[model samples]
Target chain A: MDKSLQKTEQEEIESKRKVYREAKEQTRKNARRLRFDESNPQPKKDSVDSPRKRFYRQRAHSNPFSDHRLDYPKSPESMDWSKYYPQYHDKESNNMLQDVEIADIGCGYGGLLINLSKEFPKTLCLGMEIRVQVTQYVEDRIIALREQNKSKDINYQNIAVIRGNAMKFLPNFFKKSQLSKMFFCFPDPHFKQRKHKARIITNTLLSEYAYALKVGGIIYTITDVEDLHNWMVEHLTEHPLFERLDKQWEDQDKCVEIMYNSTEEGQKVERNKGDKFIACFRRLPDPEI
Target chain B: MKHPYQNIVSTSTHLFVSVQNHLQAFDVEGNLVGSWKDTIGHEDLLKKQQLEKIEKLNQEPEIKRAENNKKVKIPKIPTPGPGAPTIYNYIRDLELTHDNKYLIGITDSDKSIIIFEINLNEDNCLKLIKRQTFPKRPCSISIADDNSTVIIGDKFGDVYKIPIIGENVPEKDLKPILGHVSLLTDVLITEHNGKQYILSSDRDEHIKVSNYPITYVVKHWLFGHDEFISSMVQFDFDRELLVTGGGDDYIYLWNWYGNKLLSKYPLRDLIEPLLDESHLPPERFLHEDSPKEISVVKMITMDKFVVVLFQKVNGLLVLEIKDETLHLVELFPLDYPLIDISAGGDKIFGLSEDKIITQFTFNGKLTIDDKEFKGMIENNPCEVQSKEEFYPLYTMNTLRKRSEH
Candidate 1:
């Protein structure tokens, strides 16, 4: 072989090896980004890219009865909303400029929060998820969106996610009549009769929800399980503090439409050709004794 | 093989002590006046309830599938085997009506509230009038101020109201007026400004105040605790003040009607020195280095002093209320840990381990006067297999919610 041809072959091999090494390094970086470091949760400088859903996958069900270690404020006055909404913090008063008015319980993958962030740009929205990894995924997703839109309008700073057991302590995080809207999109069915108490919607838990919600506030619920839908309807209707909203009301409501299509669970149900049942209830004023 | 008194209650003429399934009444002179033991009828009732539960459990899957109109495979209900026979049925939560005309006690064997007519003059001082079984074990009960109604709080977090003199309502037809998702620890009926209120506390550290009969109207939640609440007491000197204690290291003083925390009296500093190896977390925790925890077992208000008992600790902590704050007055230690405490008039009776009763009175100082009732309850016949059999006496610690997945 000629010396020039041998030199060209050597150069080609060197370039191919360099490409392999760079690809390996990129894979390593992605893996690190996916791993959640609970102690050091700050996002990396280059985390502007969207997180891969497959990397943040977790079990869909969590037992509400179990003693899950959760961090929550003792009362609404003690909750430091500034940590969640840093942009809304007022330095002189040492508090957030506005309270979170909308809450998405069991916000799986946070699709609804992302959509609501743009729809209600002025309102602060919070997503509470019980599962740890899923909550971290949503936190990362929001951080990346905010970083991507750093200089643009609607920077995704209005939406945040927190790990919590919403069933145990709703009043601890929100003051009496603090919330304007609450969404329960595609909650766990808990089909067994013995496990019915563990369901999100019960006559007892409704009182807590009513306490946290304003008199005119709305509770939006949607599920693919017909039984669960009726269960929610029956319980909400039975509660004196809540009244079922008419279908016509649901048809005109903005949150109802967003809830039906924006959640990851809702989208999955849609793809499977499942029937989706929706119910809306308005919190009623307390009766004078 | 002596069994400690599981519960104690007092009236002007008689002192009632329950040892396992046997209840004995003693006069002021330490003479046994009347005695009654739980009959075989209670066992029969328990068996019937167990069978009914199994039947219900077996039918549930079919009912759920039909209601859903979906083909879903539900897990099969396991049939429990006849494993062993144990004498765990004991009398708990003994109380007397305001008029002292009736005695109420909860029997665990059948999960029934037994109401007996009290007549100290008759040869049979106690006469069983009604035995009402509940869907779940009744953990705590309170009588209405008018004495017309009895409020029962069960282990499943349901509070049911039944007329004190009415017929037994079938369990299936009974409805809970109010409930919590967590296990109920205590329930109390109190009145302020002529309006009655139902105060209920649960293992989730929630103290809910609701309007009686209109239990749907939740007035507010007293929300300062971070651990399970085991005991609660209302001050007689000031009806507005409420004292509560539990798994936390502190007891709280609150104006429950106003939903305000007046003070938190720290107990960890006093309890930490009394902890032993038995105070370690359950064996399932895997973590060997976790610190010991305290569980407040019982509390009673006596005049201006609030007396508290902790699980597995051989002592009573007396705190005095002054200037809207609780100050530790005395750490009254005993030879054995007290399993239960009750107050009548100005006297406090603490039933300790191995069938011991220690009487106490406060006249600017904590004084013990066990001479009258010491030998009276020692001869009462209730059996215990070993020291380990007293584990139930310290079960308040089990209410502490573990962080395991």
Candidate 2:
């Protein structure tokens, strides 16, 4: 065979191998997209059978004005959290010895809790989302992850998600000084002047948060909205039981990285290239009068 | 048999009388001095009256000729069901300050309690000073002894201490001092050994006693009522003695501080006679085990007399307490069930379920005082026609003052 003929055949073989590799990468991308959120049923792309585009829209829910009914356990002691995180409890013993030490208020999509669970495997974490469907989705995601990693050493057994209005029932789930960390990632802004009270961070709510957290417990808050971020920082700074930690301290925290990268809202903000304001505060020890 | 008086509370010079939809003021002579109908109820009443007038006009031959003119219609208003908030909210309870200068009353409506400044010093000027509205409907209210703070217990079992002169207090500032686990039925601010405490009873049969002002520390739970604890009163003579009546057929007297049940007075036998078949709706009894649901609707306690009104019963039991023993001294029967009763100035006035106001005179005999009210006879008897002219402090003349109507 001539040299030119041999080189032409080799080039054809190389092009075919490149096509095969590109096809394999496309298949992997499809698999990852399929597993993004099974709870949110998405139809196949480029199909006329699916009428609704953007199936799971990301519109923030407004503040509940009237007839806001959220079920709450009678007391912190009365709540059977084992149902939310069954693996935490010993099946044979049927006893729950561990309590959730980290809580995410308004845990929309539960990105923070999932990420924090990896950083603090021994500490139990809970995400409380008021919206029923969002809570169910987060719960389903956790369940799926738990089942997927059943054989692996890394299982999501220490995290759980619950449907609850954290503002009204924070004390109902957490005993005094039970929580070490509380996360507030991208909460509803409630922008209107009349709706300022509906904001999650208030003087009264700060007292409640202080009661639930330990003396040195840290409150991790991040928001793309500057007004809400400022409102939270002002409230936490003004609160007698809390002292705002500077940006230097926040940069050193491991939870900050997971909080910025892990939450669904955080990822959305990253994709949009929005400015995120992060603030962390440590609950101060009670003053000896 | 005439205008029904459900609850009659008296000030120094006048009585704060509550009928079905109106809280009227009257002298001891039982004349309507001034009255304020619930604004909500007033709207309903006006609509009903207008409809009746239209109905009469429709029957007339002139209406047929002018049918085209009457084409413009009035929108139908929805009727309020049981426990529904209506325009004319019922006056659940009322209280007068120590000086009898301010009269505060809580209605059955959500988020509002009306306050009236009674200037009987100048004239029989009963002016609605303010409407203290909040996010939550107050189930029970107790005026502090100093008249500076009003303690309100909401249906959510949260107790809030509202300043009487809170002109511009924000809603967030009024956080709950203490909370119960269930719906609160009644709350009272009682003082013992110079320290004030809040005694609150709930539908869950739990009477929580908490330290007032600083109410986070729960003192005790006086828990004995089998069902919803509806009415509670602290003995005027003895601060420790508490009398509570509820869904149960008996009234329990408890030593609150000691957390001890002193006595349980059974009213089942006495209440049965008052429970005439006519009083109860025929449909209600068709269901199984309805008779046992008979509860004490109201309990009015005085120094020596205790008046107990049974649910679905027309008459009230007047028991005389002599040496810590209760004897059924009087059982005043009525054609209509008594809705509320209040005792003041040595007289008991019972408001029936309907528009009948019966006065059981000092000796337990029913007497009808003159229906007409003698006008306000004060040192400076000035008749103010409009609420705007009377309450100059408030610019908005809300249709709250019943006397204006």
* Predicted structure 1: lDDT: 0.83
Q: What CAPRI class is candidate 1?
A: acceptable
lDDT of 2 by residue, B212-251 (tens): 6656445556656656788887667888878888777778
lDDT of 1 by residue, B175-230 (tens): 78888877899999998888889999999888989887778777888988989998
Tell me the whole-model lDDT of each prediction, alpha carbons only: 0.83, 0.68
Please give the range of 10 consecutive residues that has the lowest summed lDDT in model 2 chain B: B396-405
Q: Output per-candidate TM-scores for chain A, rounded to 2 decimals.
A: 0.85, 0.78
Per-prediction TM-score, chain B alone: 0.88, 0.73
DockQ scores of the candidates: 0.42, 0.03
Q: Please, what are the lDDT tens digits per residue for candidate 1 over residues A109-195?
A: 999999999999999999999997688778768867876887888998899999988987786799888899999999999999878
Which stretch of 10 consecutive residues in model 1 chain B shows the poorest summed lDDT? Answer: B71-80
TM-score of each: 0.87, 0.60
